[model samples]
Target chain A: MKILVCLGNVPDTTTKIRFDGEMKNLATEGVQWVINPWDELALTRALEIKEGSGGKIEKVSVVNVGKADAEPTIRKALAIGADDAYRIDADPSDAYFIAAQIAEVVKNNNFEIIFAGKESSDFNGSAVGSMLAEFLDIPSVSAVSAFDFPDGKVVLKRDIDGGKETIGIDTPFVTIVQKGISINPRIPAMRGIMMARTKPINVSQPVAVDTLVEYETFELPEAKAECKMVDPENTDALVDLLHNEAKVI
Target chain B: MDFELTEEQLMMKQAARDFAERELLPDVIERDAEARFPVRQVKMLAELGFFGISVDPQYGGSGMDALSYVLALEEIAKIDSATAVILAVHNSLVAYGIETYGNEDQKQKFLPELASGNKIGAFLLSEPEAGSDATSQKTTAEDKGDYYLLNGTKNWITSADNAGIYLVIAQTDPDKKHKGINAFIVDRHSEGISLGPHEEKMGMRSSDTHSVMFTDVKVPKENRIGEDGFGFKFAMKLLDGGRIGIAAQAIGIAGGAFDRAVQYSKERKAFGTEIANHQAVAFKLADMAVKLENGRNLVYKCATLKDQKKDFSTLSAMAKQYCADSAMEITTEAVQIHGGYGYVKEYHVERLMREAKVTQIYEGTSEIQKIVISRSLLKD
Candidate 1:
């Protein structure tokens, strides 16, 4: 069995940001890069399955859609235990374009399963996995909390509003993972890092896909007002303030 | 030029840090004071793959590299140095030596158990008479046909009482000084082997350190490591790698001290302002930060060099020396930064200060490292 994991390269959680006047993108100086936290669960679950299933997995591949600069993140995934890798040489403009590129790759690979994060930390759109599944014409289950592979089928419990739903699916499918899927991803040792350097990472320019959406401008949310305390002695003043000034009681 | 860590390395680092914080930190002070070795903690380490960080996966080990080993050790040391030392000797000195030099049959028998943490391992190198000059070992191993009769005294051995296996170094040929030395694997259950009472220690008291008496003990010839008479060279080679573990320990001590100082400096007030506002306190902190960053860089470089199988003897020694001294210096300064509180056991710095002193003394002394460095340069 072969598994493909999709990873998102994003700014570290503690990164300090600033905008250069011209480039319109956030400045990159002093920024740390990390694998999206949710994606870690996907990769870790894949590794666990490979181990628990008695090395039944023939290959573990990671596909990333980004510019050439994203190679390090791809390399990081490889070191984390992916057997082989692919990089679609394009800056993902939105979820649809990213999904289409991944689907293009999936059409030829015949991978038994595809795993991805439920949402990218930066975008929080939670759309790529479902979009990729739709484009590939395969079934997809999102926000999976647990998974098991038994006799060529996957059993899973997916998260829902205030509850969960258990489902089972056969091979050639996609799963969008959420947090708490597995223990935090294991770090590649120094030796694993060295070996990852030698592994092959195939890079190709992704064929452009037409899109209906485009960014107009980025805007900031309205700032919050300072809190005011109610005076204990003046009940009538507090009532008037709540009814008029604050417009709430 | 490629300094970025692989994803797996990142994962291991996170796991070790999380484990150290969750499992080791809460018990450190109590264990150190009571001179207790938490057996459960050791077993937990094994369960989590700490024992087999550098061992091959085929032997039920983690099949991790030396860099991984040091990184995990550093994280554990940050919580408890005693636990870190036990792990270092077990992984670097004992397990690594056996895996590298032992025959295939020996590897199959010993590596699996050791790797799985089912059995603990110890290395016996120091004798009462030979420490800095380790080649002057007085222990002797006589050829008794199929078995070697080992008779010797080894002191200051970590995990001596509880370890199931010991990698002992003894002079096999009485006539040939250092060249006559040989290494052997001895089981603690052997008829003539017994452990001495635990030595009372100034620091790292939670680790069990004791002496061993080998009275006409018999070891199978197959247990010998590498070729006969190669023991002296092998011991040096093993220690060169072990120095990296020491460096990690040193980093841990310094890190513990640095963390306390950073927190206290931010919160403690003196003369109506945070003491951190004082230039005197601030300068001292700056120096500690500089030393710690430099020491970390040196140690990381050494670990990386080791993974490439490069000749990094000098770098390893330098990292050990610099980091150990830095730990001692930084911890002392950390105590000074705390003033009256630093002298009290209630503060963690006092304990960390005591622990920092040992890193300079063990593995290889700071003076011995200078010799290795000078010798390497002179030859070059």
Candidate 2:
């Protein structure tokens, strides 16, 4: 069985977010990019499945719809034990475009199982995985918190309204992974990093897709107000301030 | 002229940083307080191919360059200097010595286990009488028919309690003085081999440091590292490389302390504003940053020279001396910047300060490094 993991490059969560030119684009000045945390988990889960399967899972490949700069992040995934990688050279403009490109790769590769993060940390769209599934016309499971393979069948557990519901899916499926799918993402070892340099990372042209949404403007959240100090001797004044000014009980 | 690390080197640094932050940092303070050796973490490091960072791949190593080794080691040392020392001793001193000087059979027999982390290796050169003057050796290896009988005591030995193999320097011909010394690889479990209790160190407490004693210990003739009377040169060559590792460790300690100082200065309020706003504290941060950068440059230069197979003996000495002194000064100031909080163990700067002092004293004292440097410079 061949598994394909879709990786999204996102700014490190700790990076100082900044915008340039009237918020038209994110400033690329001093930001560091990393593999999206959720997708890293997805990749880890794919590796786990490959390891747990007794010679059943043959190859685990990673696919990315990104430009040349994202190759480092893609190389990182390969270092974490991906067998091969496919780079669809294009700007990941929107969820639809990325999903279409990924779907094309999936169609060409005929991967038995596809894995992706539920959302990218920067955009948090939560749409690419399911959209890719729609484009491929295959079953897709979103928000998968747990997964297992028993008797050559894929079993997944997802959070429903209040509790989790388990579902079994056939092969040729896609999964939008969330937290708890894997405990922690694997850090690439030095040996693995050395080996990844020689591994193949095939680049392909992006498939054209119509984008349906575009951002008009971006704004930062309003700043918070400073806390007001109350006089300890005047209980009545504090009570008045809470009831009238602060509007607290 | 380019100083940028390669992609593979960057990945190595990132991997070490991730492992150090997630695994080594969590229980570091507790381990320091308890003087506990991080057995599980070392095993994890071994599994990650850290034990063989610069060893050849044919010997089960990662086949990384010297700069890569130092880069990864700096990350590990930033969080836990004790663990970093263990890796440094194994890679720069023991495994490196064997790989460079040992025969094919010896390499095939030991490198695989040592690089794979299945067995830990320790370098035994220091003795009670010989600290900086390493040639004055009290250890003796009497030649026998098929084996040598070893008798000596090595103090200040890192990983002494847990090591599976020991590369020991012992005197074979007393009349030859330094030339009489021969290096032997001895099994740690050999009969008559004993270990003293772990030393109660002021810092780097998590590393198992002990006095190793050998009484009539038998070593196979095939385990000799190189030609007869080549132990002194072997020890010196290994120390040269070991200095680079120590320099990287010192830089990491200073960097860690400097980071804490910066973060603390930003959060700490004094005189109705953050302490970082004060010129006094800000200047200290600047000085620390300069020293850290200088030390890092020296270390990287030495590592690069070694990778290029250049004669870097003088540069390695200079790097070790300057970096170690910088670590000591930077960490001390870091504690001063923290005022009372820096003296406490919970803040972590105090431990860094304590750990920094050893870098100046070990591998070769600062004075010894100066001696080496001056001797090389004045040689006609």
Candidate 3:
């Protein structure tokens, strides 16, 4: 079985975001790029599953729909033990566009399993995985928190309303993973980083696809209120402020 | 000259930062308080190939450039100074010395194990009577035809008990003064070797520092590094590279403190405003940022020069000297910025302040660095 994971290139989570003068596009200057945190976790889990498969899983690969600037992020995934990677040479314009480009790669290669994060940390669209599955006419499991392939049987557990649900599925499917997919994203090992420089990243031009969504502008969230500290000796003053100003009482 | 780090270097830096923040930061304070060695963290670093960042892949090393080594060491130092020193000593001093100067046989025998971190390595040069002077002959390796009988007492040795291999400097022919010194690679478990109890240190307490004693230990003829009487020169040459690693570590310590100072100033309030608004505290933060940046550039320049195979000795001394002083100043100011909180251990600035003091004293003292720099300038 061959596994393919879809990665989303995003800004480092600590980056201070800014919009251009028109507020329609992000200011690209001085922005450090990284793999979306969720996608990285999915890739980690995929590598873990492959490592434990005892040669049952043949290879694990990654695909990203991005421009040339995304190559470094793709190489990082390869460095984290992805057998190979595919870079669709196009801007990730929208969810459908990304899904369409990935669908082409899926159709060309016979992949037994596909993994995508529940949502990209950048746009948080949460649309790509199910859309890609729909494009390929395959079943997709969403919100997968725990996954295991034991003795050739696929087992998945997801958190429901105050409970957990387990499901068993077959291959040729997609899983939209959330947290608990893996504990932490793996830091690329030195040997892996050295070898990643030689790993082949197949670059293919994206097929034509129509734009499905557009944005006009962006707005920054309001600044947070300053924390007010009350003296430890004055509980009555704290209660008075809570009742009069905060109105929590 | 391009000042930017390559994309690959940035990746290595990020990888190190991520690993240190996740694995080392949480328990660093606890480990320091208890003066416990970070054995688990060291094992994990070896698995990640951090222990041999600059060695060749053929020698079971990471095959990375000096800049990568600097970046990673700096990141690790920011979280745990003791662990970072262990890596600095092992890579820049022990493994790098063997790879650079040892014969093919020595390299084949030791590089794979030391660079892979399967066997820890220690450099033994400072005896009870010799430190910055470095030439006093207290330890002797009596030449015995086919082998040498070594007897020495080395003080303040890092990893003295835990190391599996030792690079020991001893006087082979006292008639020649410093020229008579020779370096040997010896098995730590060889007959007649013992260690004193760990030193109770004020800073970097998490690393094990002990006095090592060798009595009539037999070392094969092949274990000697370089030609006879090359030990003093070999040690000096290797200390040049070692200084670069220590400089980077010093920058890490200062940068770490600078970061905390900035954050603390912004969050801590005084007179109904963030302490950062007050000129007294704000100036300290500003000075810290400047010093950290200055030290960082010097360290990076030294790393780049070393990478390019240029003569980096003078600059290495300058870098080490400047960074150590800067780290001491920065950590002290960080404690000032934290006010009462900095006096305690939990805020980490106190620990950082203590850790920063050793950077000024170890490998080569700030005074020794000045001497080296002045001598290079006065060469006529």
Indicate which candidate wins on DockQ. 2
Could you give candidate 2's per-residue lDDT for residues B91-175 as a string of tens digits? 9998999999999999999999999998888999999999999989999999897988999899999999889989999999889
* TM-score winner: 2
What digit string (tens of lDDT, one per residue) describes model 3 on residues B1-380? 78999877888898888888999899999999888988898898899898778889988898999998999989988888888888898999999999999999999999998978888889999989999888996899999999999998999998887788899999999999999999999999999999999999998888889999999999999999999999999999999999999999988988888888888889887898899999999888888888888898999999998899999999999999999999999999999899899999888999989999999999899999999999999999
Model 1: per-residue Cα lDDT over A47-166, one tens digit each? 888877766787788888988777777787876788888889998889999999999878778787999899988778899999999998899988898888776567898989999888
Candidate 1 C-alpha lDDT tens digits along B71-90: 78888887789999999999
Q: Write the number of the candidate with greater TM-score, choosing between 1 and 3.
A: 3
Cα distance off (Å), candidate 1, residue B380: 15
C-alpha RMSD by candidate, in order: 5.1, 1.6, 1.8
lDDT of 2 by residue, A76-189 (tens): 999999999999999898899999999988888889899989899998899999999999999999889988987678999998899999999998999988989999899887
If ranked by TM-score, best first, what sequence of candidates would result? 2, 3, 1
Off by more than 4 A, model 2: A223-249
- Flag clash pairs in model 2: none
Best lDDT among the predictions, by candidate number: 2
